[model samples]
Target: MADTTNRLAGIAYLTVDGTNYMLAGDFAYSVSKVARETLMGQDRVHGYSEKPKQGSMSGSIRDAGGLSVASFNAMTNVTVTVELANGKTIIGRNMWTVGDLEVKTTEATFEVKWEGFSVEEA
Candidate 1:
């Protein structure tokens, strides 16, 4: 039997400008911040400052998700929301696509990735 350890089951959706698209398999996201740096001064460590945080989301489009390269390229103020079956919600706001999307017909997969201004978990 296969062991199901730490498996995540969820649904992810994207709202570009104002349109919403339900995502398919391989959905994932992450949040990160700049590495803390130690100030170098005359004597020793001084203090730490605030660092910018970044969020990213990636997923495959469901069949007939109605995603268009023209519209995606012109997107502004994008947002992505993921709802896990574990009763957790992750929201990414003010996002933009990182690069051109790649569509593969063999497996009916359309991959998309976005970098966002912030990520909120609730």
Candidate 2:
């Protein structure tokens, strides 16, 4: 078995339209498969297949700094590239849209959520 303890923190980031965002602070990403089953006959045997589907990415960033929430808020569609802690990268390829944006004045931070038609690791 692989040693889980060897894992270390890596860069978590997102790029929209070739512009880098979320270079610092805490962030997370996840991808899930969309699947369906087809019944073959009265016997109830079924064939199953799956494919990449819509995904979500969320995280919080401390200090607004140079980050622009307005740009993301006005966006209807965007291409996002996310680098995970494990050194894997996922590219949304113009299928993503910013879903939510929240700014906390007391904490001087902001959080964002993005949802898309599909997501794949590249």
* TM-score per model over all chains: 0.66, 0.64
How many Å off is the CA of 20 in candidate 1?
3.9
Error of 1 at 58 (Å): 0.9
| Whole-model alpha-carbon lDDT for candidate 1 | 0.68
The 0-to-1 C-alpha lDDT of every candidate, in the order given, reads 0.68, 0.67
Q: After aligning candidate 1 to the native by TM-score, how far in Å is the CA of 4 from where it should be?
A: 15
Candidate 2 backbone collisions, by pair: none
What number of backbone clashes does candidate 1 have, counting pairs of residues 3 or more apart or in separate chains? 0
lDDT per residue as tens, model 2, 1-122:
96646566765777777887645467666667675556576787777666666676666755457767776677657777877767678776544446566778887667776677766777
Candidate 1 deviant stretches above 4 angstroms:
1-19, 36-53, 63-66
For candidate 1, lDDT tens digit of each residue in 9-93? 6544555545667566777777665546677789877886667767787788754645465565565577667766555677888
Query: Which 10 consecutive residues of model 1 have the lowest summed lDDT?
Result: 9-18
Q: Best candidate, lDDT-wise? A: 1
> What TM-score would candidate 2 get against the native?
0.64
